[model samples]
Target: MDSPVQIPFKSFIQLDSKSATAIYLQIVFEFIKAIQLGFLPEGTKLPGSRILCRLLGVNRNTLIKAFDDLESQGFIKISASKGTFILSSQKQVVKKEGIRSLPNDLPVAVDFDFKKSNILDNPVEGSDLSLQFNDGLPDARLVHTDVLARLYVSKLKRNRNNGVWEQLQTQAHLNFKAQFCNYLNLTRGLKIAPLNLLTTTNHEISLFLVLKLLINAGDKVVVASPGYYFSNMSILDSGAQIISVTIDEEGINVINLREICKAHQIKVLYLTSVNLYPTTISLSAKRRIEILELAREYRFIIIEDDYDFEFHFDNNTVLPLAAIDTYKNVVYIGSFAKSLPAGFSYGFVSAPPDFIAELEKHQRILASGVDVIKEQVLTEWIEEGEVHRLAKKNKKIYKERRDYFVELLHLKLEGSIKFQVPNQGLAVWIEWLPSFSLIKFQKKCLDNGLFLPKTTLYQNKNLIATRLGFGSLNEKEMENAVAILQKSIAEVLIEIR
Candidate 1:
């Protein structure tokens, strides 16, 4: 097909061999000029590379190279099925006078309206139950904004007005990191240096930065099957091959991963070893040790997502593999986003000194570095005993909520719903099978103002289970939610029968 977004070659195929400019580059500039002139709109797809090569009467290699150069510069995008299309541009493209108007045969209008990739508009925003189950980040209502206000005020008053930029190695920043280390040592028993922890804006940024250092594009990484669906998206975005190891009731099937390791050279073994998603089972301690041993023998790294280590509402607290990774093979990841607060915007990566150095380099390259003062505030929270105090306070409140939710279920719908009381977690995993799909149950529950995420949100669409986040719902709300859920489940079962 001809280019929908076309640039009539204003200049002949002039091979300027004597000049420094390559012939392909000469053609590239002319094409760019057309795009700047409004000849190409947003939806307009460029001709096939072969067609472009033929029309320009240039070598196919040179044409393809020019196309690649344009793509890398963000002037155009190469879609999977739609071919190349004009990307958002800032400068204008000027066209020559007396050019014929756009052909009547062309359908797509070339508009340079740039926008970010589509974002999922969550219906949970501003929901009445929003405070209860919107576990994506720290609720603005919950964070102590006054603390942040003071910190930023200090920067303006002390640092900027004096013409002294805040030193990255200031005493405040260092103290914060040290306190973070102390929290880890106390909770997980891993005595990390404050310098070893690199606080990130969030988990997604943290994972992306770590993966860049540890994984080359197209390298093989292993993850638990039906795992955090988002992890698979992240891995694939990094251009890495994902090997899905089956997860059973005991968490990741370590035995199967080992067999895959024998068959293929794996780069990273990613697991949410702490209260893994969809199914709230942490890896057995024996398998945790076995996984690290395998890492040492196989020369790969273990990406441990201790995402919710603090909320384990159980006395027999499960240990994270990072706590016992004496060999430095485990890259420990912790996030306070789901644990205590959000907008503190902190998650950490704890690894060996070498990986830590490489991670800093990667941060510089990736621009996902932590804010110095935010780190300080968190460290102060730890030192001032706010974290532990908050944890202890929330524990009583959340545990009561969990117990109330469970008790209410027993009273309202005992035989129909089955779930486990997790050792320590805000959410409980439930399995229901008088043959009712969770989505069907969710739809029924939504009518009564009780909103919960179905298991399909975390795993494959076919998997039928539900995750009830009790941490966000209070005692009165818990009983109310339970009553609504009981009716919801009954409605689902009635349809199934």
Candidate 2:
């Protein structure tokens, strides 16, 4: 247009004709990347679309589309009747006379230090593996993300006229809490009220809250050996001494727990009653009753994490111990993550009203409150019966996947691995033959584009097992992963031989 304004960015924008990404998107991405990489400084004007199109050998419409996207994404700015210029690469950086300056200038260099807790460790960064089984997570694709987004948007608009503070203090939270208690009552046979429930971001947070309330320094708490590592971490963070009881076919050994309780003044006992973590074995009905009786006699707390209550295969699966906790000793917690979409994690703890009140106080100090918007949308989903619908749908799909996965395991590595056909949950516990090392097998799998973490490998003095989840994988991914796993086992076995 006016003699085609010149720019130095011609070398930065390269288009791959055969790329799966659209040409316009490629241009937009390159320009944004250039800004991010600081090749283009703040307020540096981009070449005119006419000149850019001629330089890049792209259609004028395509160039314009790229320019529009860059401007819309805040990577660039276009002034009417003026040229397009790069936005400040750092949003916080100010542009003065074409020079970027921080809003707050540092007087001196600052160094930061952080102390690592013995309980909580840093998160493991993920690799670019082709497929990896998670710890019994639901298929995110099955979640009604579109419906949830629409519901959230509707709630936002409805709350637009209300003040932010008012919105925070709205009855939506109370309503959701009530609905959640009702859901628990119907499903778990627990007569819980809204006052007995406290909602957190996830089960971990709920568990932490319970531990904080119950555990004191050097106080004794029992956990299953090689159990939910995160829960054990929470207990340690709360300054509680741990007594690990072994888990068997019927879940954690109650006899061992009784011995530990007698030896130590046990304050808390954390267990997954429905489907134990890693090992999807439900605690027997008799053990559940015994544990409840022991808790009352010993005056200890039971933190029940029923994370996969909805995925049971049988109709008459044992009701949660909390349902029949006559002494009000159980702090029942459950996660919506197994039932809802990814990025949506909400959990509730149903305990005595006094415990909940204390937990609420601590929760207020930690976070302002539960996400009101999310709470409202979830309430709508519950009332509309979408949660139940989705849970039922997920259970059906997971059951099918579980069956197919177990079948594939048998077909592929029948003699190499021993496993129990689980009745519920998303994973199968595969115990390796005595000859093979799971560590070597895991490393080989990771080397072959499958990311099985060592933490997923449960090893004691003699036993080695792993929980390979199938809920998140489709048929094709599952097949490929199983094949890789089989090959990996063979490779490891050959090395040992």
Candidate 3:
């Protein structure tokens, strides 16, 4: 029999006085764990209670109690003349062959297998660099966080007495849904009621819920080439095969869509119609009507993601397709993330009431419920017209930034790039002329302390372009970023030569 000192009881057996479990019970659990793990062989003799109590920094009474419990549990055998010895159980072996010390840390990797998907990988990159460009995000600096906090606090104080269950039962968010419906109706020309709207934490979740309801595995879904990557990921994750169509300056080619519809049974058509992603071009009204007509004829559903509806810089901004969706063929998704501050942002789907009811069921499973306090605050924000006021303010500021950014691009990169002044949205799509390597350019820019996220870079056989967001950068930052871009392009071009 091995001596008790041969085993490292002090290393594995630890007691936490702060825990609700008694010290005696803790000791028993540790001893059983060590024995089952083969660290303590069946014939190993344990130290006396007086010695173990000092080693474990516990009272003699606690150590005695632990020993009694372990013996009663059949984990240990005590004799009058012999010391206590570990006993083998049917559940575990007591032989120390190929055994190592008991694990003192949590597992680093899962022991079981699960379905792994490369399709669901996140494309967005993070950077600690001060100068960075995103693919058309609202300026975080413009968000009135102080005002939002005040509103949140005020709502909390007023509802201090209301229990969470009671608040949920009352359905206080109904008022917010009603206000959001009215806001959408007035701004986007959508006639919807609270029952027709369902809100989620953000735009992606809203889209996911809608697709979960409508799409089945192996179904054919149509999207534009060089379209929103995140939405494409969601569609593929739902087991739907994606079919790509072309996008021109006027927007998605309805003629091409018509041909595809003839060839395939398309289930859903997804597009950001207000401002086509990566390229800030609005789908023309003529094409909108044609697409709606096609949807009616083909019996396909159109998902119009009017993500930046409130930030149109040009007077020719077209109303969303849902406005003229006479056949109930359009499911519209919109987000306050584009207009409001980050934390205060929310996304909602506006569709037929029955469709929304089904979507609410899906949301209940996925997200459980909306944040009560946030819903109330946003409800008051909309009802009190703060949402509108902020939208107007942001539009003016972003428009000026856009113009200034355009001017800088023309001045710094006159012959090297080609672009059109964006009519709507917060980004400008610039095609790189003379086609030097964009990957090299991205690297050079990074070395110079300017971060251009991979999500903003678009490359193909015929085109090399990037969607440069101007909304988040002020004039000084824009100028600095443009300078870095210019220098990087020059360096990359020289290397190619």
TM for every model, in the order presented, reads 0.69, 0.76, 0.77
Candidates in order have lDDT scores of: 0.66, 0.76, 0.80
Model 2 CA deviation exceeding 4 Å by range:
1-114, 123-125, 163-168
**Model 1: per-residue Cα lDDT over 1-497, one tens digit each:** 35442555433233333222356555555455456445565556777878777777778887776776566545678887878888754222111111123443555554678642211112222324432353322223445567667865665455444443455436666677677777778888887896678767777778878877777888999988656655665776677777878777778898898899999999999888878875678888878888889999999889988777767677888888888888888888877635444566577888877777777777777664446556665665777887777777667766776787678767887776577777767777666645544434554666566655422333222344566676666677667777887777777778768
lDDT by residue for model 2 (123-187), tens: 33244555887777777778777887898899888887876656565677888889988887887
Q: How well does candidate 1 match the true structure in TM-score terms?
A: 0.69
Ranking by TM-score: 3, 2, 1
List runs of model 1 lying over 4 Å from the truth: 1-163, 337-341, 365-370, 453-463
lDDT at residue 90 of model 3 (Cα atoms): 19
User: For model 1, what is the C-alpha lDDT against the true structure?
Assistant: 0.66
Cα lDDT of model 3 by residue, 185-246, tens digit = 98888888888898888888899999999999999999887788788879989998888888
Worst 10 residues of 3 by lDDT: 90-99
RMSD of each: 14.0, 17.6, 19.3
